[model samples]
Target: MQTHFNSEYPSVEHLRAKAKSRMPAFAYEYLASGCFTEVNLARNTSDIRQVQLQPWYLRDFDGADQTTELFGETYDAPFGVAPVGLQGLMWPNSCQYLAQAAVDHNLQFTLSTVSTASIEDIGQITNGRFWFQLYHPAEEELRDKLLDRAWEAGCRTLVMLADTPTFAYRPKEIRNGLSIPPRMTLRNICQMMMSPAWAMGQLAAGKPEFQTMKNYIPKGLNMKHLGLFMNKTFSGRLTENKIAAIREKWKGNLVVKGVVNPADAEIAVKHGLDGLIVSNHGGRQLDRGQSTIVPMYKLVPEFGGKLKIMIDGGMYSGADIASCLACGADFTFMGRTPMLGVCALGKYGGHHTFEMLKKQLQQVMEQVGCSKVSKLREHLIAESVPV
Candidate 1:
């Protein structure tokens, strides 16, 4: 497939800067800021860069293939777009755009339950090939309803969120009144006024809502009630019983996200989960936790073959993906990187970012004398591994 990269924004930093400028202050802060002091957020990316891959300069090279096999299917690339809630608020139609792009790229796109787009909308876009990340609704009836919708729509891979037991105390969201429908404070309105592109797009696209849960929301409720309703409706904490129940109901691939340690990983394995995503909720939940890269040194050797070991969080560049693979991650995912792409370049932003990553990863593979993505661990630098 021909790539659609714009020479002007070759790297993630360039796309991020452009996105920041084009987006409103509240929206940008929502997308960029982490909880508390953001120690974990910064640590995630910083530690990923610390990992090094040794290059072989004089070996018979057979080029490189980026295709990855996962969950009984082969994907064009190993990495996919991780689920990000409020994606439409960051960039209008970004959720829909990304779903389309992931399909075009032969990659996975996980849709969050709180995302602006509904499950059916994405199902149509991906022809039921997309993955659905359940937020674990409070009621079994509600959860079963959601699972039924997803099944009818064609989602075979269900990602059960295991990290967010409660909403983190993000200072940015608190100050900005970042609810489902943003609080229209004078400051927020002014910020929106400053970015015409974002403002016009939001206006044209209509107000972003939790389209997946729209039917259950009470009618004639104000923003405060809506927020309260949302808080009461979905449960972020996933128990062993919850996992077992889902295991019984959903007859498809089940993955538990936000697992970083052995104890939590044990629960997934006990419940017969198909995979474990070593993530820190993009460092949005815990400020002092270890970077996603730090735990892989332990998780991989213990459960690598038992289940598909995937990862996400603090990944920014193709080299970051390479570092994760070298650290023994079977597959990878990215939240901020791909979202920044859609926010930076609009409709085709996903294409540009995915293409850039493929090219960048391909170059790394060829230069390191690694012929395939699965062989990336062979190039790992023993002394400088992620620890």
Candidate 2:
């Protein structure tokens, strides 16, 4: 697919700037900000940029290809859309829009448990080929029900969110009143009014809700109580017992996201998980944590063959994706880049972002004289500066 985005928004940073300009301040900050000082947030991308690739002029190579295989599935590209909660709040109907785009592009689209679209709806869009990310519910019955719903919808891969044992203290979110049962302050209202296009889109789409969890929420609960309900519904932390139970219940491929430690990766392997995504909740859950790329670099050599190793955090471009692959990541995922596209161009955002990333990755492969996605590691320069 060719990028429909013009030269003005040729890069992810460009799309992000446009997204910030087009979206309301509160919404943009919610999507953009990390917890507290946001040190890890900035480090995520900055550290990735530190990785340098060497071009080989002497090597002969055929046309570059970005096809990648993970968990028995072959994808057109090496990177996929990382699941993000409250996606519709960024752009109305964005979850479905992204799901459809992923299907059309033959890429993986993981749907969040807290996303605006329902499991069945996205299942229909992707023909049950999409991955489902689960936030462990407080109740076993609720967890079982959600799993059943996902399986019935034809979802085969389940990504269990392991980070976010506790919510991060985001000063921007607090000041903007973007928390649960969000406070609609006058400043926020004015910010929304300023972004007329975003306001109009929200009006047309109706209020964003947790479509997957709404069925379990008791009716007539006010926004404050609704917040309480959400808090009570998902416990955030996953224990060994909880993981054991899920392993027993879920017969399909199981993956644990938010793994930044080697010990945790070993635990997931012991638990028989099919894959592990080395992430730090996109730097939203922990402000002082190490950049995801650092841990990915350390853990890949230890557990690359033990299970399918993937990484997602701070990757905004195809070069970033290539860097992760060179460092030993089997696959890559990006959360905010695609949303920036959607927020910047409305319905055309997802496709344009995918195509742009594909083009950029293909260029990187050609420059390195690498022809296949799996061969990206061969282009890694040994003794390169540490990320």
Candidate 3:
């Protein structure tokens, strides 16, 4: 694929700055802010950056290959887009646009249960080649229906969220009136008007709704009712029984995201899960919790061979990805990084982000004399903090 990357915004920081300028205060805060003081959010990236790598400048080198095999498919890169709810709210049609970009670039994209795009929409866009992350509903009937729809759409991997046991205490969301039953204040409206690109895009896309759950939602309901309905619909806390039930119903690959402890990982393996995404919900759910990387040093060693030990949280660049890989993460995923790309550049933003990440990872591999994705551990020089 020809590079769609913008040289002006070569890094995540640059893209974020551009995104901040283009987006409304509420929208940017929704995408970028975390719960409480955002201690873990900042720590997630800083901790990963602390990991040092040893370069092998003189080693007999074969060219670097970023290709990685997860579950059954080989990807051009080891990282894929992490599932983000209400993607369209940040940038109109972002959920749909990212799906198309992932298809073009041969990378994986996971659609959140509450994401603005429907399961069928992403299924059609990726041609049945996407992952569905279920935010387990309160009703068993609802769960079954969602699983059946995903199966019919040709989705193979099902990611059950183990974190987000409750509604987050994000101060930004509260201040922005983005908590359940989102209220559009005059300030929000004025800010949107100020952001011409965002205002125009929202007009074109229409007001963002939960497309996947629209069928279940009653028609003509006000924002307050819709928020109440959504709040009652999802259960949030995932239990062993819920996992077992879903395992029985879902025939394809099953992965549990937001796992940070070996005990939780042991349960995932016992329940016959295919993978574990070591995450703290990108630090959205936890304020004082350990950054996702810290647990990887423990989880990867114990559960590495048993199941695919994937991770997502605070990874901003290829070097951050290399640090996680060196710590034994089988694959990586990012929500804010790719979202920053889309919010910065609109339509081709996803393609550019994927391409940039691949290029950065390629440079890291060549610099460290690591040719394949599987052997990055050899380049691990030292950990920033002991587990």
Candidate 4:
């Protein structure tokens, strides 16, 4: 698998720096900020980095392969693009670019419920293979309609977000007026003017909107009313009854995202959910919560074979993916890093970031003398590693 990435930006950090330079301050801050003090956000990456893998120096070895299997489908790599809302706001046409890249590279691309691209459009782009993340609308009818739309568009996996019981109080977003129904302040306009590339891209792609939710929203509503409509429309809290209703309605692979507790994992199993993405909303929803890796460490041992356990939050590179695998995650998803890639290089970012992560993961596998993605657990150095 040859990755045609730019040599100058080889690492995700490089991509992040470039993305920051390319995007407006408000957009970059919204993409980068976590809740409150961002303690958990930093911890998600730092704690996962604590996981150590022992390398095998002398062995009869073949080249490493990164193919992974999940939900009866095979992916070229163990990692895929995690869903992010308002993706086009960060980089115009990012949703389409990443979806096409995912299809071309044989990876999963999860489309957020509020993403700039519509469900049907992304489904067409991925040939019905992309996963759709649901925000859980307040009305049962609306929820059922959204599910039906996803199913009709050929989405087989529905990632039900359960972490955002309420939107996090992110200071950066609040200050920038980047919250729901984002305020178009003069300062924001000035900032957008500063980033011509991003501004021009937005001009070409048209204004970023909740394309998936637009049909349900009434026309001619002001931003204030729109915000109120969004607030009333999406009820993030998830109860067992709600899960059961979703299970009855959606006849697809239902994954409960934002699960951190072992008890919740049990509840998911009890409710007949297919998988659990042990996430803390990428550390955006909860500021003081435990790192995603911590819960993953506890959950995998308790329910490894009971249900599929995937993880996301602070995963930045191939080594990070390898770390999660060594810690017993079935598959991994990355959000900000891939978005940063696209923001930095526009059309090239999608394939470049995907290939970069794959290349890095292949290196880790070779270093650990593991050939298959599932065998990454064999390299875990459990004793000396600090969680």
Candidate lDDT scores, in order, read 0.90, 0.87, 0.89, 0.87
Residue pairs with colliding backbones in model 1 are none
Q: Give each model a TM-score.
A: 0.97, 0.96, 0.97, 0.96
Q: How does candidate 4 score on lDDT?
A: 0.87
- lDDT tens digits by residue: candidate 3, 229-311: 54688887989999999999899999999999999999999999999999998888889999988998888878999999999
- Alpha carbon deviation, residue 264, candidate 2 (Å): 0.8
Tell me the lDDT of model 4 at 144.
86
Model 2: residues >4 Å from true position, as ranges?
Answer: 1-3, 179-182, 223-230, 385-387
User: Model 4 misses residue 289 by how many Å?
Assistant: 0.7
What is the Cα-based lDDT of residue 343 in candidate 2?
94
Quantify how close model 1 is to the true structure by its C-alpha RMSD in Å: 1.4
Candidate No. with top TM-score: 1
The lowest-lDDT stretch of 10 consecutive residues in candidate 1 is 221-230
CA lDDT for candidate 1: 0.90
Over the stretch 278-335, how does candidate 2's per-residue lDDT look in tens digits?
Answer: 8998888888888988887778888888899999999998999999998888999999
User: What is candidate 1's lDDT per residue for 83-140, written digit by digit as tens?
Assistant: 9988999999999999999999999889999889999999999999889999899999
Model 1 spans with C-alpha error above 4 angstroms: 224-230
For 194-253, candidate 4 gives per-residue lDDT tens digits of: 999998998888888889998887786554322354577888699999999999988889
- What lDDT score goes with residue 351 in model 1? 95
